[model samples]
Target: MVQSASIQLENPQEWDLSDLYQSFDDPRLMQDLEALQQTAANFRDNYRGKVKDLSAEQVLDCLQQLEAISQQAGFLYAFPALIFAADTRNAEAKQMQDKVMEAVTGIENQLLFFDLELKSLDDQKFAELESASVLQPYQHYLYNIAKFRPYKLSEEVEQTRNQDSLTGRQAFINLRSLHLGEQEYDPVTTPDGKTCSTEAELSALLFHPDRDVRYEAYQSVRKVMQQHNSLYAYILNTVAQDHKLENQMRGYESTLQKQLLADEVSEPVFRAIMDGTKSRFDLWQRYYTLKGKALGQKIRTCDVYAPWGNDPVPPLSYQQGVDTLLAALSQFDVNYARRAEEFFLKNWVDAKVRPGKRGGAFCWYAHGKHSYLLLSYTEDYNSLFTLAHEMGHGLHFAWIGDRQSYFNSNPPMVLAEIASTFNELLLLDYLLKQAEDNPQLKQALITRQLEDQLNLLFRQSTVSRLELAIHDRVTQGSFDQSFVNEQWQSLYQDLCGEAVEVLPEHQVDWARIGHIYFKPFYCYQYTASNIVSLACYQKYREVGKDFIPGYMELLAAGGSLDQVKALRQYVDVDLENPATIAAALKYVEGLLDQLQATL
Candidate 1:
């Protein structure tokens, strides 16, 4: 069973934002909406048919104007959607979110002709526009658009595809989010002997210090899911089928191929990371054995996350956690520290738990203007780590906010995890050093850190491999319920090895991972990014002051460069190297050795 961390803050505040607009119903939103409609109309009127007649400079100006208009509207749409996610029960916010999504989708459809029309221009005309000064800033975007020239369909067909997407493929995603993805768990008696059954409460049970409670919580959650499996199976099958159909229509060779193309990463690089992780399954098996011994159990699936011994939950105040994060970040770069401090001072974080709030944590950046974080803060060591993790994402967005265009603003998921995981590594190392005087505390911290690494790195990689296999089988018309369950069980057993006993429900574990339903093959990036970040963290430790500038530059680069180029410039780590994964595993092994010796 997966227990959630505790969330006990009362009077939790929402994001205080007067930066983008005055309020949700502020005049500025209306003004932007009017301007967007006008500009989009004007763009269609001016450039819809005269692309061959316009000079390169004129074309660039038109593109820039369109980009600016789209970006402003994006900012307006994003904030409310983020706020709604933080509290799904907000009916008004939900309605506004749906309205904004429809508006944005309509606007996007209006601009869909711009690319196909541009691509239709003759070579000489296209070349002239590419060299225009006004368009130089967006040359990369233009170049990418041009790259799709060969794949371009007729303008009418493209428009139909664009419009159909919102109501067809995209609407299915919304349906899944609203219905199938909600995990309902049965109420369990808390330590105070009161029964509660909220998502937050069920999450807390996963980390329960008592093995029996953790097992019971796991069963209760799975039972609810088991009852809903048929519904979930329907959602999964439909989404996967939608993706397969779209990929075929888009001329993509495979589902993973589409993701790789979008991520700007090579299939070889992704496969390398998977292969490297498969080679290091023993590290996870060893760690689980140690964890099982520590918990005095023959490790059931629920015991994977069970607390070690009866150690008192280390109390971490919110301010203390912030200070700890600031101090650790200061070691790498002062700018990161300052940016994090600004988030707290400005109330950019909604850090309290309340009724009807969202279940998970995320950092939301609306048009690179400001970042908002949503989390239910609990005063525990893991909470501190979580704070740092989300703040890492916030800082990354903040650093690059001013510099990147909308198209280049968001990094790929594989690279996105680097900043967050790097923060975790820095905080863990800092805490380990601070606890050096207390051997037992140091051992416990080390164990906890290793547990996290196992989850994010090894275990997530295993899950990704299973997902890839499942998708591949589906493409070959071989996937079914039994096929998915068998593959899940195989991966779990492989990772656990002989060190632990796999429970029965654990066989259908893939059904519980929300990402597979929404984000196919996204879990592998968690493993890859952590491995890449370990190398980056090692550089920061070795080079000290010299590493700060490079680190800051990497964050500032955002999605301006592809993942490989960005990492190469920032940390000099090659994704193709098997040694990168080996190095990360070696670090994990060292931590385990230290814990074993000390404990």
Candidate 2:
């Protein structure tokens, strides 16, 4: 629900979860849960502790069954999850979500022995199973499991971790979401006498032409975050320690080793991207200096997002935002537009922010052919980009799941952001075209485009660096709120260097960052995917239509192809080599040069 505005903002809306079930109380829900449990029991009864004894055909059959059971469970859980996200205050939905999670835990427990048994096979025996021609389709999925063989805990410990997480790390994440959803922000008066209050509204001021407005919004946001300082810091440390303890128990070499293994990305590739971005910190510094000089002030962290010129991009309604995103995606492929259209036309998108609703957005897909997208979509330039971003994810899920089986439907996390970020790049190009004749507007667009690159490439790298530091530090000793604040501010200074002044208020941003509390070591994916998308965008710039077919093929590829293998096939990117990152760095520098020249 947006407040008063000059334009007619689209009303916030909810999605119809009926496609999954008529209601939460639908008997089908219970039937599916019971059946999932029964199916898991049967699977365990058939395959438990028997991987070494089973023939190749038996292993394949067992995997197929496991896939089917998991899909059914996913379908069941998606509804309550959607309902809870759509309105976290709904008592019935919360109860249903809790019950479903409890049931799913039982299912995880029943199926716990399957993967452990699979990982237990000797190398020669495992090679024989993997070499079976009939098992080719499951090769990617099976091969991924083998990577975790060294880290595999006993079946009992694995199940314990699964069950314990509902109360441990996950509960902290849930609390943080609730804390963010219910928090209030006081209205700040803008230079133009406008009053802003909502999280979305205050956020827009951070990029306002008036420095006072941006400073006030910064102070207001930091004030709200500091109000919950102790709680957020505790949640962050708890989550970090949870990961650290789990890593030690599971025999993981590093805290991030599990995510690397899970994402199917190599260590060298992740480091290459991090090192590449850090090595090119001057580009970030240069952009900040140029933008700050244009505004006639030293750039502060609050001013880091400032546009090159004061001309504001007009407000784009939610419907207009969808149209704009689809039009940009249509330039890529008709199928991309078609899939994106489903989220809007099919009533599959929930684009609203309200008390008790989730604070951010995510596009969710189950075994079904469709998707549901959630966003706190305020009608602004940034909100429009958010729409494009989430819808990109919707298109990816719709395309990939349509072609791949349940076990093979999800791409590596590092590559997951590619389609989403690519859509944003498309939108940026489209926006630039609209501003060709207006100098101020064009400068604003270029500023936004370049700032977005910095945010994704450089800012995410800093967050990743901080996350790694936190995880490594938590292993040794205890930390308090001040300890975290100090580390966060230090990283901020390191990223901004002498170009952007690191504001004292912005250090509390570390406390408010939900991703660090929720998904350990996940922010790096944004950087990794942005680099890959930049490379693909470069190819599209050169070959035009010749790039679309292969690009579309990459989206259609799920876990059926490993990330490095898929990138090589689609874009010939050698992700392991420093050159891939070097290329993206060069692109960023070129964009900076273009912006400086054009503006």
Tens digits of per-residue lDDT for model 2 on 399-421? Answer: 78768888888888866889899
Q: What is the C-alpha RMSD of each candidate to the true structure, in Å?
A: 4.2, 3.5
Which pairs clash (backbone N, Cα, C closer than 3 Å) in model 2? none
Best by TM-score: 2
What TM-score would every model get versus the actual structure? 0.91, 0.94
- Provide the global lDDT of candidate 1 against the true structure: 0.74
Candidate 2, number of clashes:
0
Clashing pairs in 1: 3-203, 3-206, 4-203, 4-204
Cα lDDT of candidate 2 equals: 0.81
